[model samples]
Target: MEHHIYIIPISTEKLEMTEDNHSMTNEFILIGFTDHPDMKTLLFVVFFGIYLVTMVGNLGLVALIYMERRLQTPMYIFLGNLALMDSCCSSAITPKMLQNFFSEDRRISLYECMAQFYFLCLAETTDCFLLAAMAYDRYVAICRPLQYHTLMSKTLCIQMTTGAYIAGHLHSIVQVGLLLRLTFCRSHQINHFFCDVLPLYRLSCVDPYINELMILILSGFVQIFSVTVVLISYFYILFTIFTMKSKEGRGKGLSTCASHFLSVSIFYGSLLFMYIRPNSFNEDDKDIPVAIFYTLVIPLLNPFIYSLRNKEVINVIKKL
Candidate 1:
């Protein structure tokens, strides 16, 4: 027997009703992977495995960093925060997505969707800032090795991490607050796997000009600022490495930056592709694969990238 998923649209008369009545009944049907019913089981198994790896790897990395006193440095601190963010980020989407694979109704309440979007925004934005912070730490360690300890003090590390979380919350609140103001009527069928900002914004019956502007300005600032910091840090690091007399110094510097650079490339590449455009311009069908990479795959890959590249994490794990 074949199972078919259906999304029943709200009637035009109902859409014309008052905001109060609409709010009471507002729900979104997520059109996630329904087009490929044949792959439901396969997708579920694949995503389930990815989700497991993401949870174990990220949470393990966090625990490892916290318990190992020798690994307690500015770099590892930022890495622990990254692992925490990745775990939270994957958790926000993967569980629901895996559930939807077997369930007939893929319906999510409006407020629930908003909550998911808020968390997603928080995690992703926090990650951007945290990566920038990591780059700065690397720069100080390599470029100013003599003064690294004094420059990247324990207090400063905590403050920077705290600042990243605060910035993330502020960005999420503004975006989600603006989202609440928009009226979502007509068709409540969200043409995506999850309740992303762009998909939700597309459902708005009212003009989402303010929301779009806010997304563009805020998201653009975070992305550009983070990338700029990382790039500039690497630029100086490269210069410093070239001027070094020893080949060992150059090799060590490149090895440290390579993993970070690879992770940054994957992250910012997907991020830029997804958000650096108007909502209307985004092709919903095309976005799923890209979204899966950042939201699901990246989390799974981060721990492997950091652990495989850094010997300290490996030694700590072996000791444990």
Candidate 2:
């Protein structure tokens, strides 16, 4: 069997060019926070601060969920998983990103870059599912309060979390598998600090029709599926609120989904802006900033959102 490996046509002279030419052409430079050496310290400090906050916030949520049995409902269970996913996703990118910001090398080997992307995509996708799961849990608890326990049982909770991990990782495997079919050309400079699918796609010399289509379809589905879940859950929640004769009941109903509502808006808003629109409309400079909200800021915000909104979480935290 023969496989046609597509490649960019490098001129014979260019391929056999001087060492300097190859070094410049073959090198994959990372676009870190800044190119200036003096900026390294500033970037390191800023990113390091953000990274610390993310870790503390997520780890603390994990702890709160574990120690508080009273908080051991499907909502909190899914929240704990979301916290874990957020922490992992942030860790997957931020530490190396912060390091790259400071280091002189500022170049990741092709394999290393690919590996980073593999996990980054995996964790982020998992967060999407996890958040949706949290929404469903809220829906059951609020809209179907009488049957909440029966609907969101321990077994079902475990399966949803398990399914999310399974789904997210399976999604990633599909992408990495697709990438394996493509070949890397001499171009190695990754545009952003950490490896991302879009940058890698641009760098490939091969026809990426298959990979591009898969991403478009798969990403669209993840967006639509998760958003639909959130919307449907909230719609029922709103209907339940309308039916509630007690003002207290209605307030409680809306409050349960508020954090999730804010989170969904932020995450999906950026995603829709980035992937849902025309190809030529990309705000490339806004990529990192957009990434910051979902990747870094959202993780930091998770624990705060849950704790501030849920008296049980705050009370539990105070107890410890």
Best by lDDT: 1
lDDT scores in order: 0.90, 0.79
1-320 in candidate 2: lDDT tens per residue?
99999998877776667665555543467784664667787877877898898889888888878877888878788888888888888888888888776467777765666677778778778888988888888888887779987998999999999998998889988988898777667467766677777666777778788988898899889889999999998898889888999999888878877888988888788777666667712335666677767677777777788778888887777788
lDDT of 2: 0.79
Residue 2 in candidate 2 has what lDDT? 100
Model 1 per-residue lDDT tens digits across residues 1-320: 99999999998877767665666447888887988999999999999999999999999999999899998999999999999999989999998899899998898988888889888999999999999999999999999999999999989999999999999999999998998998876688887889998887777888888998888899999999999999999999999999999999999999998889899999999999888844444567667888899999999999999999999888888878
When superposed on Cα atoms, how far off is each prediction in RMSD? 8.6, 6.1
Q: Quote the positional error of residue 203 for candidate 1 in Å.
A: 1.0
Residue 6 alpha-carbon offset, candidate 1, angstroms: 42
| TM-score, cand. 2 | 0.88
Model 1 deviation from native, Cα RMSD in Å = 8.6
* Candidate number of the best TM-score: 1
* Runs off by more than 4 Å, candidate 2: 1-27, 35-38, 280-283
